[model samples]
Target: MSTGPAGHVARSTIRPHSETGVEGRKGPLRTFLSTWDGVRIDSVYEPGAVVYEESGTRSGRPGSPSGRDGLVFVVAHGFTGDADRPHVRRVARVLAGYGAVVTFSFRGHGASGGRSTVGDREVLDLAAVVDWARGLGHTRVAVVGFSMGGSVVLRYAALSRVGGGAGTGGGEVLGAGVDAVVSVSAPARWYYRGTAPMRRLHWLVTRPAGRLVGRYGLRTRIHHRDWDPVPLSPVEAVPRIAPTPLLIVHGDRDGYFPLDHPRMLAAAAGEHGELWVEPDMGHAENAAPEALLRRIGEWVVGRAG
Candidate 1:
């Protein structure tokens, strides 16, 4: 175990690219990052091919922007996913072509502490990971989130722009350092139960039986309580992310959220965001193709500067 920025402990494992799905001379640097509220988040950093360095130490000092050097893609996975999940790793691997990648499990997911508040407080997790990427010598940081994570990236970008948010780290100032944001397969509003899949998901989160299945079957731990006062929705958050390049990608055939969800977000984004209606695409990271990931990388490379 080694010490990372802000005194966080990091463990580096040297595994083959075939095993990890991360292409690098050295394997990924795994660490536990502390959120502002003190939740220990399970995180991983993979150096991209373009910026691969063999440095023994990489995390930079906090608040020292001058020390930041490259572009880093911070990935927020969909519900029930952690950094080690194959789909999440694939997304990270593809985005790494443009720059380094930082992937983390949300609170209560994977090895992360606490329980999943779904998308409400997950903004804190994304904010902390983005800050970590910036501290790792990355001058530019872009967030790419899928499904439930997609809502989080949108909220995080808005919170960063708006200064502080309620229930998101106790109104803590957050997400200020983000350069760009991408939200794929996100919903427009909260409490959406338009489709059969969503109805089933609602049961899974709201019912005792579903939470039990989530923990034992899917390896996901969910919070028993519901959102009180409700956090800002994705549509409400998009209007505030001005001048920060925002990309909203949704599949035409997404089962969880239909095309209308992306449409609502796009309309709210106005001229500040770009919308892509992927043809024949399904949903989230599990359904994203390599070509789509490459296009996203290209967009980040062009806009994140």
Candidate 2:
């Protein structure tokens, strides 16, 4: 990556050891996400958790991607999912299998730093995590964000003409200079995320959860004034990531964002991004065929390797 106000710099990271990986070559990734039955975790940006502590192994034992680039994967959870959400953990484990260092945490869900920004300030938190991971010696980086987290990654990468540059800590604009991206049900419509039912049913459970997060001061924790979720949509972000490769996987039956979101992004990005519409999956579901995951993995390898 070019070095300037938005250049890459050295950061710190803590590495953990385990007994698993894709093809058993890259070792294992420590899963820092907590479980649903566990207590809520708090998010902190103070870098007090020891650059790279091996919090734990991802729950489901996912292997590395089919290819190898030694790039890191920063997985973001959904609107209702914390660092420990099953699906989130699954994505982490799978990316770890490919030998990529994976990370996800309870930004607002619990034990992370800062409250949820609905996707606004939380994107900065994601940038922090990416910086921390890069500090650990990762040269190439990829992002996999689900639902709301997905939108955050997209907006973070967009940077566009705002919220970029120095505010990102030493020129690291987007999550450690992402080499590739895969966003599942990333909200394309900020103004209508919750209001759109069929395309956003997965968020039906998130609406109440977001309000609960606000009760926990996530609104104040993330914003300076009034809080609104419309600021997190990817619809306007797709074209911002000019040369970066992207894989947008959307469910034909999504209940939150209209299918048009992915379609519009695809149309906007053209050859720069790939759009895949699942035939039978709902919003934020694990129903995406393994084939799609393989494509995403291959895409990362194609770009970063």
Candidate 3:
């Protein structure tokens, strides 16, 4: 356990059993750590529990591989979201049904330090969380991100393959590589403010008065500088994620980003990726239905295992 800025206590622990002990239920271990760039990140680890044991292997889809022993999911929340948000927790809980789960808050959101560079600098935060998951003894790690986080996961997966020292702040070490990636409701390009919600979001990050609201009201601090060389767009990063399984999920009814966004990403991903155009779903984590989330969980378990 350690103390972070503003006296936030970050601790890591693994419990063997829950108080109720509902047969095979287990507890989650949480910790707070810093990225290579020195940004604090709040994280949680949910140990895989045995929902049903049969023939020395857990049950799963017929003809599919069983025994999800080493799979772990690192879930990154959308804009204005954190590890503790109900929607984030819901996604974590669903993923936890299959294997271990890791959920975290990006810097400038929740209790972490530094300002949100939106999707640009958030890749470092996901890298750090993935590193921590690897350190926790999980051999196969998958990254799942929503909205802004969706873009971050795509970029992280792409950047991580270009060797080890690109985005980790000047010679700093790179985190472990991700085995699978799931991006929900992400933008293919940058500076998109076509929808009302996105226009409002743009105002929140670009305007001084809106940034004040972001800092105090939303608990998210916005960085003022523009992208120096213009970070890779999600579409540009998708092709680089090849050989590694990629899943791009978006809602047909999403008001924030239209179908064109996911379509663009899926096209760039080529044969290495799968696309799910959800029916009647809205935006990001909040709008994702439980059924859709379960499908996503199943997808991660199948691929990451």
Candidate 4:
């Protein structure tokens, strides 16, 4: 097992990729694919391609060397966020403590390459991460997302179906494995949300350059159509993830989306899903102590089911 930054430990199977896709040998463009079999990662936050299984090791009782191997957790940060955002970093650390080596950086965020698709195009990036994880010999994998990242993660889990999501479908699944997901502060629907920084932030972004880049990429239109105000809300997409366990986490104090949204999703999930509202958690950030993180880890790692 290799250690991620900050002494994080995980199963060292998949490697980070150089580019966003097109895995192969390293070239000047290796910044886009994989140099080592497509799953070996070169960096953790930069636009990455592959990731190894992260089974973080924790320090047990002073004399005990035995420790639990953690679940592989993929964390997706919100728009304008990177793997290093204080909140993202904190989430990574929390998951790492539960035996997870988390990795995530949506398009246009962090060191990842490409323009922001808001959440649509970012779904492709999540797909790539999941593919790389499967290559590393893991059957059960879990995902955690925050804010816009939450949308991307939900979309990915849904799209992975043979046909639930529109674009590239038929993602790798363990026949039933890789069935857990958690979305924190995810908008029930992104076509438009209430009055908050979400819309303002999208309008505030400089997208002319993103448009230019999208022209060469496969799914460029997502950025242009992101705010169209017609797509199904996250609640609409919840049904697609059935059979696979889901957890919707929202902060009661969130300013971006309503706290009831997650509860609404949980209600829909019924026995296969759950919803947790942090009394003091804010938009895209969870500040709860060990109690919340522990339960979250258990839920997403397949223990809750």
Candidate 5:
């Protein structure tokens, strides 16, 4: 691993053993980058693959869009999850099979620094990662976020179009935009502690004791201040993401946000959005089957690639 001047770290090669006969000739280059807020984010980048058919024509893997270059997917994990989490890695692996993949730790999760703003301010983290992906030569970038991260992706897409920037510790502002988006199990509005998991999550983010638990027990730091200006909600942000293709995926059995949340987001998305209410599914990345994730990868490749 080598460290850049900005304290960015490039870890493992996306694919270390080309001699092993992997389908793709190359894989993503893994690295770390800092958010505008001075938060160091752990990130990975997978290189796109090309397969040649018997007709001597080049194409991507099945479920992937053909004849595209520099296609990339930026994956965001749920609250209490990090870049290295098993579920996050699973999603990344599936997406990587289609094209390049960039997965990162949101601030206050995994090896990243800074307290969790829940959905607010986390946009900076996503923006920084997206910027890094673009810098790595990805012509098309799509973002996939789950749960709290899902909400952040929705807001990020909306805010990016309006020149919204995240606050740095210094006076500088950083802005990053994306071409496509996928939100899974995201809440439409805030402060709805209806389900048991959400009620517990509310306590984890709201109470002092809960913050302490989050800090030590969960390794997630909760920001002390509440949203003063109250950032835009997911449903509200949906309309703003017009022309940017959107896919809202939620499990029919989701206990946290319920079916109404995805429905609300889909309704707000209007013509540009598609909704997948998966049967027998539960919540977030943990419950998303590999088949479902591959389908998501296909959607991203078809739209963004």
Candidate 6:
């Protein structure tokens, strides 16, 4: 593990190997899903120990709490992260304690076929996974995203409400809607180069040599084209996500966007959103502690109603 841009530890592609994945009763359910733009996404479904029975129905275990039944959490990883990333699997395992979790690789990451669009069109990748979660009989769905993914979830939720779950290129985005949304270590606006890490990240995304490094060194594929028309920023999308439970989490010591980012999102959220300013924390999922993840799981169970 290497020290992240700020204070926290950021595990690049070179980290100690962790367990293969979190396994359900029948083992990890893995598959490929197609996004609205026809990009194939690699997805994994892990059932909560207390959430689902062998038949995929609610277990109703003796001490299981209410509101957990039929609930599914769709986890969206940060840039260069895929469903199988050790950090992502750790998050899935913790969230699975409360409900089933559906995690997927965006267009250009993991085994999925396509190049990364950074954050612009990744909404389609999330939409495909959310729809798949619904198809699995989950009545309540919550989306949890980190970093770049955080931006995508915000945009996705807003688009779901405003566009009625519509997709581009004539592809029907029937499953784009979600019941709850969580954005962690996300930026409020786009094109922010306020920090060193972000500046390096921008270089990695915009330059040809950077793309090569992302592909060979980081095992992530990035698209060369830029966003034709910049999508709505996270702050702009927050107000539109109202009526749906939205949670914005940021660390006081975050390396990327400072406290202003989350604060901006909270201000936009008004009464419709909740914010958690973590103490002594750094950046995205790599820095999110297990206890915090559990608290987030609890929030999902309680709010996804």
Question: Evaluated with lDDT, which candidate comes out highest?
Answer: 6
lDDT of 4: 0.55
lDDT of 6: 0.79
What ordering of candidates by lDDT runs from best to worst? 6, 1, 3, 5, 2, 4
RMSD (Å) of each candidate, 1 decimal: 8.4, 9.6, 6.9, 10.6, 7.2, 9.1
lDDT of 5 by residue, 144-172 (tens): 99999999899878766423433222323
Candidate 3 lDDT over residue span 33-75, tens digit each: 7775577777777776433244435654222112446677889
TM-score winner between 3 and 5, please give it: 3
**Candidate 4 lDDT by residue in tens digits, 162-279:** 2232322223331112457888888876545466665555444436555554444423222443343343357766777777678888888787777667876777667877777888
Evaluate all candidate structures by whole-model CA lDDT and list the values in order.
0.78, 0.55, 0.77, 0.55, 0.76, 0.79
- Ten contiguous residues minimizing lDDT sum, candidate 5: 9-18
Per the 3 Å backbone cut-off, how many clashing residue pairs does candidate 1 have?
Answer: 1
- Can you tell me which runs of candidate 1 are displaced by over 4 Å? 1-26, 51-69, 162-172
lDDT of 5 at 163: 38
Model 3: CA > 4 A from native: 1-26, 51-67, 162-173
Lowest summed lDDT window (length 10), candidate 2: 44-53
| TM-scores of all candidate predictions against the true structure | 0.83, 0.66, 0.84, 0.67, 0.83, 0.84
Alpha-carbon shift of residue 205 in model 2 (angstroms): 11
Q: Which is superior by TM-score, 1 or 4?
A: 1
Which prediction has more favorable lDDT, 4 or 6?
Answer: 6
